[model samples]
Each structure stands twice: as structure tokens, then as C-alpha cells.
Target: MALQFDATEYAARLDRLTARMRDDKLDALLLFAQESMYWLTGYDTFGYCFFQTLVVKVDGSMTLLTRSADLRQARHTSTIDDIVIWVDRVNADPTMDLKNMLSEMDLLGCRIGVEYDTHGMTGRVARLLDNQLTSFCQIIDASYLVGELRLVKSPAEIAHAERAAALADDALDAALPLIHAGGNEAAILAAMQGAVFAGGGDYPANEFIIGSGPDALLCRYKAGRRTLDAADQLTLEWAGVSAHYHAAMMRTVVIGEPSARHRELYAACFEAIKAIETVLRPGYTFGDVFETHARIMDERGLTRHRLNACGYSLGARFSPSWMEQQMFHTGNPQPILPDMTLFVHMIIMDSERNTAMTLGHTYLTTAEAPRALSRHPLDLIVK
Candidate 1:
């Protein structure tokens, strides 16, 4: 079995999920989030780009409805015994197959929860499910049900994250030396990802964001790569993944001697991260952390250059994004809890000066304080 955790751990996760289902008055939960399925039953697969769903009942029974490509995948990677394969054909609808499966489970006329916010559940597919099941069952949008449960990491999950963090640090170490004048962004990115894979780590959920010079001021990954200039700034953000768990890291490296402005911006961003770290303890709201970041950046007069949100939750995730549901932003009421993994990034993008400074690392929130996952120093990296 390719299951990462023991049977007992998976069972406990399912139990916790079913308990939440009962509390939400959900007779059955139709989960479309790959993260939810993987967290609950160790059902890891990249087959979620197509239509698929994991149905979990209040009685603790779970089943997966997926395409034929993932039939063996489900068997080898998950604890799910009853796996139904939805065939592919011209103009075939998988949602009808899902409706039939729900009916077979005696879910007709029952209150069902559906994960509407996930990538797996498209609007067209969702409408089809609603049309097919509306007469028999009440479909409730419980997008955050499993996600909320997964916010806090278990001991076993934390262990995987710690290993991933170490791998990320190693990746940075391998890539930093390559950030020289006339260096290739592609080569640096390749070295970074290669380090993670060679260390037995999995591919990250999203593409690594790598840029140099003017592109450094941008955050999102774009098409085409550039060669590093003699005196340019470069920014890299990538996560190390293990068992689908991710620990992300971000750093800005200067190819030549950094200017005074560069040092000042890096110092401000680093201080902002440090300020937030001090308050990342149990009983603090996520907003409190963002507020601290805001105060520090505002005090440094870099408010215009900083991002509105400083950080977000991190966990086992699939493609499109590595970020988890909860985020650290203004007015967020989500409380910081023990065992929650957070990726806090102090990003200061000054388009006016054509410079970018980002310092980010993953941390595990403990009862007392948040513990750093990446062992690398937070200071500005000038190559």
C-alpha cells in the first residue's frame, strides 16, 4: 500500500470527519477535494483533474467514485474497499454515476454535504449533480467541513512536514549557489526541484515561482524564463512536499552587491516576519498576526510595497495552489491553534524602484510559540 500513515491514523481521521458530519446533520458527505480524501483515507492520486468524488457516510463507511485510470490507484494508495469506476465516453456524465452510487448507499431523501469549492467539482458537474439528486436529497454546500478539520496537523503529519521542510532548506541551499551573474533561472529551478526529488520528496502542488530583474517584482509564475543579470535581484518561492504534505520557503537573492535600499527593504520584511512569529501562539487570531505584520511594515514606511495578507495555512495539497484554506489577513477570526502549520512570507515589492524582497518560511504553531521549520537564516541573501 502506498498509504503514508498507519491504518490506525487513517481510521482516527475518518472518525473525526464522521463526527463532524454528524454534528453538521450530514448523512453523507461528497468530497471532491483531493486533500480531503487523502487526509481521511490515504487516497492519494492526481486524478482529481477529472471528475471524482469520495462519499463518506455518518456511519463511517467511505467509497470512491473515479475514472478507470485511478481504479488501481485507489486500491494501492487508499484504504477504500468499494471503489467504483466511472467510464469515459463521448458526452458522458460522471455525475449521473455519482447519483447512482449515492442511491445505492440508501442516501436518497437524506441530507448530503457537497464540497463545492474544490477544483474537482466544476460548475457544470455541480449543476448536473444538483439536477439529478435534488428530487431525492437535500444537497448542502459544506466546502469547508473537511478543510476545517485538516487545519491542525497530527503528530504523524507534523513529522512529514518537518522532513519536507528539511528538504526545502536543502533545495534552497542547492539553488542559492547557482544565482550568479548570467545564471539561468531554469537551471536554478531545476536544481531546486531536483534536490527535493533526490531527497525522496514529492513534487510541490504548484509551480516554483522563479524570477530575476524586473520579473522579481512579480509574485506569480509566468511563461518563459530569463537569465540572471550581473546586478539584478532574483526571487524564488518553492515548497518541499512529502506524502503530499508541503513546507514552503521563499527568498530573494541579489546577484551583485545589494544597494542600501535593498538592505533596508529586506530588513523591513525580515522584521515583519519576526514580529508575526512572536505572536503566532495558541489563543491568537490569525488577524493578530497580520496586524503585527502591518504594524511593522507601516512603521518601516513600506506599507505600499507589502502585501495585504502576510501568510496562510499549509498542509497536504494538490495542484493549482499549495496554500490551505485558512489565511492570515485583516479581520480573520480563525484562532491560531497548536499543530497548525503556517507559511508566513514578508513580501515587499517596490515597482517604483524595480526591486523585490521576500523572506518567508514555514512554522509549526505550538502551545507556547511558533517553531521554525526551515533552518536557513532569514537575512538577505546576496550572492
Candidate 2:
């Protein structure tokens, strides 16, 4: 909370990316992805959940086109040089304003890169430009290009992320004292979120996981009506954003004392994460990272519990981080590099209860090792 962000540093970062875009034959990169927008401009727009669209010029000066009502707050928080106003009149066809802006910029047929995968640019908007502009513009996939640039963290970004991680750590510490065998999972989640807010952090995504008993096996478990039991295990994974930088931390805790089975699953996951962390260094292949975990699981005879890759790149913003492993999910095979941040979680699910026992943390990659940005207690906590 005591940290201050340098907007000039962010502007310079975007300017560098824009320079690369120009060299790559991009006339002007049209970015509509929320994460991409935040990366380019150091502002978090939860308002995107309503009127969602932001445009970025290759030269780094940008404008966010959204509902007229949102423009005021967006302006207040925006660190960019310009703001384009898009009035959403009732039954007035808001797309017209967007079409007009594109035409004014003369972006047609510019070999533009569209972050369509994340932008969600609809067919209607695509057709609108095609018909109104009277010119054909080749829309290229720009997700990876921008994602690669964001993979490495600047010192400032790492600092903010470290602070965010610390906030999460404290929040977990505050919430853990309130956990009990008879506590409701929902109540525990509320306390955790309250701690986050009290730390002056905004829960932008509002995605927190709290599961216990048989309900923890689900991968994306939501806090529900379930109550913690004396023998039940609980998982709490949460994230917070500071100055558009995101920090994620997750841990497993037990109500009262843990059972023998809980200890086994927890220990195995911790050992697996430790095994995965030991082999992480620059020049290591993504394949090698995966094999490290594979070897550990095999050695422990726990191969059946292997869930996903050991970890992935992370950033303060929503762009990709450096640990690009392609085997699992939508990832790249890119190697880890210095200044790259990674979010890693090793989990072993309880088949009987349909819940997961998770251990998660963030790492800042260095030439020798991935530095631990997360300082949360790695061992399973017992209330």
C-alpha cells in the first residue's frame, strides 16, 4: 500500500512495444483486450464489464472508447495521453461511434494486428468496418506478439507485484485465525476478502476459491453454502490487483487438526512443488520443466495425481509472463528468461471428496533461480 507507480515507466514500456510493432509492419495495433489495455495504460477498468473497448496507436498514445458515463472515471484513472468518447445512446446503435472512430483513424487495410482471441471483436463490428470503410484491412493475430513483450517484468512491476503478494499473504494470515471446524466456507471467504480490502487492495476479478469437505475436488470451486468440518481440508486461492498489477496466492488449510490422509496429500504436493522449483533456471526448456515434475511424481509413485504444468508466466498486468509451457492449456514453448514472473501451483485432488489440496505461489525469474515473490507459509495450516 505504500508503493507508488511511475506512469512514465509504463509509457516508456508501451513506446518500446510500439516501436517493435512498427518494425513488424503493423500500421496501428488495435487492442480490445482488457488485460492488453491495462498493460498499455496503467489503469484497471472494471467498467469494461459494461461498455468494453480500448484502442491503442502504434505510437503509444491511446484512447479508450466506452460508454459516455464511464469516460469521466476512466479519464480520472487513465495515465494515457488521450481519451476518445463513445456515447451509448438508447437504441442508437453504439457501434456506429466505434466505426466512425476507426474510419477517422484511416485504419482500413493497414495489416493491423487484432487481439481477437482476447478482444472478443464481434462479427457485427467486423462487418461494420468492412462495409463502412470500403477498404479491406488484414486482421492479424497479435496476442502472442504483445504477450511476449509483457512476459518479462520491469523492476517497478516486480516491486508492485511483490507488494500485492505480501498483501495477500497478510490477508491469508488474518483469515486463517478465523477458520474453524464449524465455520462456513462463505464466511471464511468474506473474511479473507475483507482483509484484502483493508489492506487497500481491490479484488478486481472477485474470483476467490474456498472449498472444504468433499467439495474441494472441483478445479474452480466457488465459495458456497458448504460448512467446514472437523476432518475437512480447505483451499483458499485469491488474487489482488494494485495499479493494474496482479498478484495471485493460494494455499490449503484444514479445520481444527488435519487427518492422516490430509497430511499425505499436503506433503506430496509440497514435495512436488519443491521438486519443480529446483530445476527452474534460465535456458531451461519448457519441456525440461515439465519433465522435472514428471520425474518427481514418478519417483514418489504419485504420477496419477499430476494435474498441469508446474507453473506459468505472470505479470502485474494481464499479459503473459515468461514461463511459456505449451503442453498444458493454451501456452507457448518459450524458455524462461530473467525478469520473467511465474505463477506456480501444485495440486493433488481428493477423489472421494471431489476437492483439491492446492499449494500456489509466484516467482520472479533470475539468471540463477526463480525468486520467490510470495512469502506465504508453504506448509498446510491447521486451525
Which one wins on lDDT?
A: 1
lDDT of 2 by residue, 1-383 (tens): 11245667766778877888888888767666666666666555556545456666675656667766666666665575456776666655545675677667777666777665553356665565345434456666675677778777788888877877777777787777667878887777788788778878766444676777666665464535687777677777776556555677777777666677777777777886787677566777556666766676667656676675666666544332222323322233567678776777776775754545678787777888677777766878778
Per-residue C-alpha lDDT of model 1 across residues 119-234, encoded as one tens digit per residue:
87888988888888889799899999999999999999999999999999999989988889989999999999999999999989999999899999888899888998889999
Predictions in order: lDDT: 0.92, 0.66
Error of 1 at 257 (Å): 1.6
Q: For model 1, what is the error of residue 330's alpha carbon versus the real structure, in angstroms, after optimal superposition?
A: 1.3
> Residue 334 of model 2: what lDDT?
69
What 10-residue stretch in candidate 1 is worst by lDDT? Answer: 269-278
Question: All candidates: CA RMSD in angstroms?
Answer: 1.1, 3.7
- Candidate number of the best TM-score: 1
Q: What are the models' TM-scores?
A: 0.98, 0.85
